[model samples]
Target: MKKPVAGDSPASSLSPCEIPKSLLPIFLKHIAAFIDSLNVVVLARLLPQSHHRRILTASTSAVAASLLSQRQHRLVLAISTPLLQPPAASTRPLLPPDNGIKKNVQGPTFMRKIWARDKQEAIQVEFNDLGQPIDEKSSSELAHFLGAIARNGRYAPLHYKNWIKVPQTYKKEMLTQVQEKFQLPPGQEDWILKSITKKWRNWKSFVKTNYYDPNVSLVEQMKNVPERVHEDQWKELVTFWNSDASKRVSDRNKVSRGHQKMVHRKGKMSFARVAEKKKKELGYYPSRSTLFIECYSKGETPGNEVASQAMVQNRVCLKSINDPTQIVAKGIVRSIDPSTEVGGSRLRPNWCEVHIQVAVEWDEELIRRYGMFETIGDALGAHVAWPLFLVERDESDD
Candidate 1:
């Protein structure tokens, strides 16, 4: 009898009893499947009558060798193939039906925290405020926003022609004009680059080696040399005009030249320019004609009380000359002598002045029958108040 190798013994073969005595009760005394294999080795040396001895001896040797070789091959395959495969997972599923019952239930509620009902409530309140009320603003404020032109018409309009200097924004566009106007000779780009490179090449290497050397301080000395050639995959342009880096100081000359003669295309207004020229030639600017008028209304003219009431009503939108905080008509308007000098300066009248005596809230205006230009305040200081009246003619005036 030949001894079986490790698992190839009778234990791997079918036994008389498949159901063990200990497992018989749980398995209900049933028979389980059995493993059975055949191993045969036969050799017979009969008479040399039919050459049976020679054939059987050769066949036996061949079969035994083949079986041993097959076993060795199987062993090698099982050992070597495992080395080629990936490592087994750390944790394996339980056998049979254990996997069906296993599950992990504890995990963070990441999405639920961000999308809570409280967040939706906050957004609802925010959207409700879109229907809030707005207060009504004053019309005078709107007038100021529209570039209100005072009714006095004392000054001229601010047109482009009045400009004498260039605005800052237009200066940036002047560079294009310079390139079109000043073209270099043929191969100038190559020439300029080569010339600059040759002159500064040695200086570049020197700076790289002794960058902090007190002798070479200028950035110009550190640029465009052998070391600054940027062979590595790093920034090569530490200078201006190199890699959009700030060359503001070094490009000063080039940029200044580019902006040469750069100015706003504001043409001089012929009338305004000529006005000053004429003034210079005549030794002085021209002045407006003096307005001398005496108001003398008669025949069923309004009484002092009614006239004063109308005058106050006309100046309802008026502001105080001395202090804007104190209102005019609302404060008080009492009758005073036309020649009365309050604080040494006589009160003057404008074209709107009427001959009436009554009071509203502020200053008293004693109506004057006659008025002169010289009685007004300082003309240079712009304190002289006057109405730019458009006279309405009545039949009686002719």
Candidate 2:
């Protein structure tokens, strides 16, 4: 067989129906290659037949073509090119027949029947529109279905393999339960169950893989994001995991999504119970943080007040965050050399208490005990508050 010249109609030169079954795949492959090579303009010029135009419009639409990436759209248009040509002059009637059909009919009226028959053939052509898969159900139906499932608060159910293996009677029973819970449409139970199960498996896999480090601070971890996904997409995914939806889903499934878990404390507890008990017996009451407000004493106040205001001094211990009423020290604050190294770590904030003494300043104590020292310092070392603590005027009439 001779190779068809460029611009020649392959369908007109060779019979599409008469092609040998063994050679059909090879022939289709050649056709596909030829179509892929042609540009949109060439394709538009080639497929002048009305039925071909309709097929192009129905399947590989202009909207679909435009949605695809430049390279993909070009291929879409090329594949839409027509296969056959207009009928020959010889095939036309020599004289007017009793038949009512007109002589000047459009391209290949005889081939129109063949085109209709080819439509039934098991030829699968797909066009990527860069859109979600076509949904047989309406948007409203889908939304309603999803809303029903969400109301139940049950997500990420069992696998599809398990779902498929269950006996038809059991499947029906499960579907009935789902239907009652979700208030789904009567006949849609099976579809809803399958959709829910498949989606649950997918969601489970996604959450399982994407759960970031629980140990690392979220703020620090965000500095170096994953490279696999787009920046915006990664941010969105992070936001989603941080959202209540992720929490609810994880809680329902008893799975950890790597988010920070909140611990609930019923009451405040001291760091050293026995020591605190002994101190309490010694007439040392827990000093409330709110009561020990950093107050401006009108005139030149002590170095401690100045240091506290500057956030260079922290009198309260580590346990103070939970119970600010614990461990209160009273002393005058003074600026220190931050450059001076202390145990291989610099005194970063450069503020310390001078004249060195811990005074029992709270009025609640019946006995005021004072500790005399050369240079009093917090054994816990420098602690700075990122969020500035509240300071108020001493408000004394004096």
Winning candidate number (lDDT): 2
Q: Estimate the TM-score for candidate 2.
A: 0.18
lDDT per residue as tens, model 1, 313-336? 132222233332332222122222
lDDT of 2 by residue, 44-134 (tens): 5444343245435533234223323333445544555553222121111222364786666332112222223332342221111321112
What would you estimate as the lDDT of candidate 1? 0.27
RMSD of each: 37.4, 26.5
Look at candidate 1 and give me any clashing residue pairs. Answer: 204-225, 240-247, 331-361, 331-362, 332-361, 332-362, 332-363, 333-362, 333-363, 334-364
True-vs-predicted CA distance for residue 225, candidate 1, Å: 50
Question: Cα lDDT of all candidates, in order?
Answer: 0.27, 0.36
Error of 1 at 379 (Å): 14
Name model 1 segments beyond 4 Å from true: 1-169, 172-271, 277-283, 286-398
lDDT for residue 106 in candidate 1, whole number 0-100: 40
